[model samples]
Target chain A: MKDVSRLKSVLEKGGFAVTSECGPPKGADPQAVLRKTELLRGKVDSVNVTDNQTAIVRMSSLAACCLIKKAGLDPVLQMVVRDRNRIALQSDILGASAIGIRNVLCLSGDHQSFGNQPDAVGVFDLDSIQFVQAVRNMRDQGIIVGGEPLSHPPDMFTGAAANPFADPMDFRVVRLAKKINAGADFIQTQCIYNMERFDRWLGIARDRGLTEKAYILGGVTPLKSAGMARYMKTRVSGMDVPDQLIRRMEGVSKDKQREEGISICVETIERLKQTPGIRGVHIMAIEWEEAVGEIAERAGLLPRPVIDDQ
Target chain B: MITAQQKPIDEIRGMLVPYKRILVLGCASCVAECAAGGQKETAMLASTLRMKAKMNNEDVIIQEHTLDRQCVKDFVVTLDDIIGSYDAVLSLGCGAGVQAVAEMFSEIPVIPGLNTEFIGETRAQGLWVENCLGCGDCMLYYFGGVCPLARCSKQLFNGPCGGSVGGKCEINPDVDCAWQKIIDRLSRFGALDRLETIYPPKNWSRKQGGGPRKIIREDQQR
Candidate 1:
């Protein structure tokens, strides 16, 4: 229950934490990550390094986290069950903790069909919720998944992804509750574009007292163009992009759409600040890292709290 | 039941190139039910092979026979009287049936004319969808009689992943998301609370994870 990560400490200290994503380069280039870290260095409390986002092969999240940590930034190592089995997952957790990465995000990643390697075998040996429990068991009980005692257990803050817009709308909150019950210390949701639906899901979550169990971070992504909004609205599964938002983006002049998108993102973050049980905003400016600093500053989330890691 | 599809005529023809006299064998059970290797299909395949060989100026002769169930030794023994006259057996049965036929007549070359697909249910006319993986364990009761291991693309036991959209899986628009079906079925039964408990990682060793599996049912043994 102790705060083992700077992101955890910041939330525990009652500070509105700001986090952003850093997608590792496709090839094995560390400089690409260094460049993103340079843009994100002091603006956010912690950075979440994705594990083969969209199932496209990329630099391992652990290696990327090491690079980010070396660059004087806290890194949340995103671990997905889509690629590795339970043994590899547990092994990586030990490896990550031994190397000083303190935060881990459990995800049942995007289906392989959505990625570059559509034929790749998706190793869902453990779902995201079960993965959260595995990490918790490894950290708290000082044991591996099969019940053997580890020499030194990983003391890391575990997180899981929640998709508020996924189908079977009535069961979304139930799934979120399951994640928390499985020992997810924190949650980062899928990108939110429809505030009405997001607010409705959050209301049900609040009613069930799920908000008090774990730290919830509202996910916000700044659309780069009107076309991207349309693609996300029509093509992206589990994403609920409102048509009105797409119209708003399309209504603006071509040159001003990016600015309009940023304005909308900043407004979403500001609104999230007032929402009950929302401890922070996770800005996923995909390939648009520069926009995160501007979004954070515009939403008055600058000067992120620097908590000394224990 | 176990479902299968007939291998392409070209592939079956290629396998029969060395033989002049062959038996076009079919199973009257699961494969017959799926319309892959039934008596009617066996006769048609025999006629086509004979005509194709004649057209190509090859002296090949084919005889067709459909067994009650090729997987059973009792039915397989019915072919024993005429087995010695044929050079090989082109079995239109499933993988298990073909193997069983091969085992019964140790001397005859058995070429499979069909590829075993999966344990499936006949959804409609000419449509067979896979419904079971034969994971060696069944937990259908927990899932409202729907098997997530067999139907889910990821075989996820806990719940649906984010890829489930509007009841269709993201992998292919044609395939219904198994988890969506499970949720709806459970909801209709008012048993949605069953999903509240987190199921642990499956013991995959019961599956092919432990290598080629076998069940020695001692009670059925003489």
Candidate 2:
């Protein structure tokens, strides 16, 4: 099969790939997306545009990815089942492929209650695993959800999100296996503040041979301050922030907290590099896009690998 | 059984303001079991309304009545003769019962005093948890008898979303993650393999998504 994603090519070539995120603005401003993409340009492999992440309405991910592509960056269009039904999802995948966006990430979006639009009705027409299956079918078999053949099948790489820190911890790897079985080309995990749980989860995956089936990219989010660390621990559901990290952030002087955060992020990246099965790292600076360039450079992930556009 | 909660006292009182005479009607079936509408509740609500009217210096006649099943025409017909005596009826019944009463007496308005909740079971004393959505399709056998359509926050068929923590849903810590319950139950029975196959997107067309539904039994009908 011809490779459609540069990230996939990098990973297949056994290079340590680095990807980052760029959240579209709440309002209709192309410049907002351009500014974020520029900061991440050449600093990462591909940029993922979130689809109303945290349930807050923003510029559509499809539109934002287009902006990112135009800004000379490879874009990964993130699609969440929370907003669109199966028909719309398949349609958007076709559209994303047509618009030169080659990589896509399937996600079961954050619940609407956490977003500004709490009253909005969530449309979970397909779970993330089912979505991965749908994307793979559309790309590989030229089939849509209902098995209808497309005149031209979409050529793209598919990815799915997994959270090792979420509850029922024992079943987390089983869920990852299911995603891989459903045809996930790659897996972007939830942020890894709890290194012990992440390492244990990856070990189980390696034992089960899940690591061989899909490329696993460890997720990292740099905390800017002790307050940010505490908020992630207490307010963010499914996020595991050890008390030691929080105290480490607090251990720094107020003015130097950012530098401490970058150091911690770099340390985490260094640890992920040695982990047996990890293929890459996904840096999600969450609104602080400027921090991603620094984190990638300081962690020695700069000067991204180049591959032929297959 | 269908469950409900009584509407606020102030809202009920406001609706009764236009009427000089009102009958507080209750259903003795599902609503009665849930303690939202019943003979005892009807009397209590009638008394409260009468007291509120007296305190407001309003001349209002409040009467109370309970039927075997407000949703059945057999029980609804008994109110025919005296239906014209009241300006309106405050039906302390589930949504179906309220509509049935309204349909029976088209001349008089039937205002619902209870908000119909969901089809649920009495889990414990003073606790009713919703267990069925009546989606018109049942897949309980595959899930160890747990209905993911009703209990799962996201109605996920493949498995739990990333929001399951400590066996509770991330949306609310008090709510047990339905998939967690399913996995535990299936694991105990050695049926965890059933979840390996991905269930397709639900045919919600068979549900309210299909619009108002109806069932006609020709064998039992005259």
Candidate with top DockQ is 1
lDDT of 2 by residue, A1-310 (tens): 3335778789889998899999999999899999999999899999999999999999999999998887778889999998899999999999888888899999999888888999988888888889999999999999988789999988778999999998778888888999999999999999999899999999999999999999999999998999999998987778999999999999999999989988999899999999999999999998899999899989999789877764
Off by over 4 Å in 2: A1-4
**Individual DockQ of the candidates?**
0.71, 0.68
Indicate which candidate wins on lDDT.
1
TM-score per model (chain B): 0.96, 0.98
Write the residue-wise lDDT of candidate 1 on B61-93 in tens digits.
799999999999889988989999999999999
- Tell me the lDDT of model 1 at B182: 94
List TM-scores for all candidates, in order. Answer: 0.94, 0.96
Error of 1 at B148 (Å): 1.2
lDDT of 2 by residue, B1-222 (tens): 999999999999888789998999988898889899999899999999999889989998999999999999999999988888899999998999989999988889999999999999998888999989897889998999998878987778877888888888888889999999998999899998888777877778888776899888999899
Error of 2 at A254 (Å): 1.6
